[model samples]
Target: MKSQSTLLVICSAVMLALSGFSFFHRNKTATVSKKPVRVSSNYRIVIDKSHYELKLYDEEGWVSTYPVVFGTSEMTDKMMEGDRRTPEGHFKIIAKKLHPEWGHFLLLDYPTQTDLEKFNTRKSQGVIPANAKPGGGIGIHATRRNEDRFVDYYYNWTLGCISTKREYAKELYDLLPVGTEVTILH
Candidate 1:
């Protein structure tokens, strides 16, 4: 019985050590600069789901790029509600606000006339169910506080929104204005 107790203690110590190491490693690798950069009024965002990157552009050219994660590993265009896929197409930043959990939230104007037309076409063709509805409230935002590991690990944990590091999301929220053009591509 003494020997068994010793082995159990050793195993517990090993597990605790491993968890600590993971925590340290995640924090070290996921750290991002919080320094603010110059904001441009002509800024536009281009999110490439295939590359897991969000690139910012101004009139001059590319400005910066931030690592991003999506809703699903399939990276397919969202079809309907609960699909858990990020949609592809042009969108605009309809609103911007502070989020209680995910930090800064930049709401996107998804389901534009183009998106509606496509959704309706798919419904008519039976590609999507007649009762299906296109989802909304999509946006780009940060992972929850102290949860930068999700972005660092490419976990893709959102319902249908783009996610970045908390610092990066704040930077984006500060730089981008309402009506900014955002394009998502595969």
Candidate 2:
């Protein structure tokens, strides 16, 4: 009787684990409400770092949202190079690069005029370290092929770039053109 109970417990545990995994990895979809929707080329992207969501919007309403991963120090705004925190505030999609490692890189115009000014102010107030440097190359991108498992389980694991699935990255890359505005919020 004891051996039979142990086997039953193990089977139940396995079933629960498999169900949880399937629930988390399910396909995500969205639908528009009755509100007027804007089907325009110029769309705005909003990255909510706290929630790990990247939302797309237009003048009328929301377009779609995708799961995203952030840096180690995702709660704080990026201050300098190697901070591992995604920057917050207004930015623009500057360029897109196709690559083997990152899949597709949708570059952003970080360190905008406002960002620079804030950095200077922080420096003046001694908020940032004296040797700190304002880093660049922040963008939205995808993980390498082998790294998919890490991104799937460990959600917050990017250097500073926002990461999503390769398929979602491709969709976003195709939809957003250069000069599209992206707003990253805390």
Candidate 3:
């Protein structure tokens, strides 16, 4: 009986030692790839459409993120004029305007070009007006005091620009500058 108990103890010790050795061996061999995360020199505007969140990233990680309302209707992609759908693509920030009188303005590069080939054959074209200019004024801006914030937060309500609360709008407009790169992703 004593010999059986001794054998069991020996077996347990051997198993534990084996486990410890294997674990250390695996960890020592594991090599973490040293690579730099690509970051742009310009400001980054990240729009996660699925999550309904807009994040601004600077030289550091995420600088700011505002919970946003998408669109009253499902916003998949933008079409012709008055489509009411916010565009999703890469754009360049050309201008920035602030209005204590109005709000804030962030001019964007719009008319990201949807099916230009089809337009020549088709009667209608998705043009941003020959004179109006494509990808113009768009930015975070303020809203009304008496307005229902819930609706804006719950649904998408901008002509094309991304609008936030007055304070947050100001924050973004102040932190980010013109010539920033903005990306709207699904």
Candidate 4:
């Protein structure tokens, strides 16, 4: 009888110890603090010429898209100084500058490889200025007083850059960080 009682006591102690071990092992398997998933640099920018729109794409999907204004000569592709077509190419957001006169502007890589070729070829033919630099005068700029402020919100205007309205430009200026990839598609 005494041996049976001792056996019961030992069994109970073993069962309790096993249950405690199981609980601790379960908790060890379910750790609480895990590292967050990293986000890659896969942002994109798209431009629609017909409707004059600039769209930004993110991981989840189309993050934001804004209406834009283009050149005075909106129909044809830009060829020279007076041709009013926004430069269409792969560009990086170079810089963000606040111009008291122009409000806010986003600089683009204008006069790219093709532009350089044309510039050099023109200089060889004595058509372009000798000291002129390529890839200049390309950015999102503000509208002047005489310029159509209303339509500028929806359509294309200015020399050559993605032109957003005053409100949109302000928002974009805050969002458009440096080194953002910009692809201006015609």
Best by lDDT: 1
Ranking by lDDT: 1, 2, 4, 3
Give me the displacement of residue 140 in model 4, in angstroms: 1.7
lDDT, model 3, position 5: 100
> lDDT for each of the candidates?
0.85, 0.78, 0.57, 0.63
Give me the overall lDDT of model 2: 0.78
Cα error, residue 179 of model 4, in Å, equals: 1.2
Decide which is better by lDDT, 1 or 4. Answer: 1
lDDT (Cα) of model 1? 0.85
Error at 30, model 4, angstroms: 52
lDDT of 2 at 65: 76
Residues 103-184, model 1: lDDT tens digits? 8999999988898999999999999999999999999999988988877777777889999998889988988899999999
Residue pairs in steric clash, candidate 4?
69-155, 69-156, 69-157, 70-156, 70-157
Q: In model 2, where do residues sit more than 4 Å from their true spots?
A: 1-39
Per-model TM against the reference: 0.81, 0.76, 0.60, 0.62
> What ranges in model 3 sit over 4 Å off?
1-41, 99-102, 113-138
Encode model 2's per-residue lDDT on 15-39: one tens digit a residue.
9678543223324332212334356
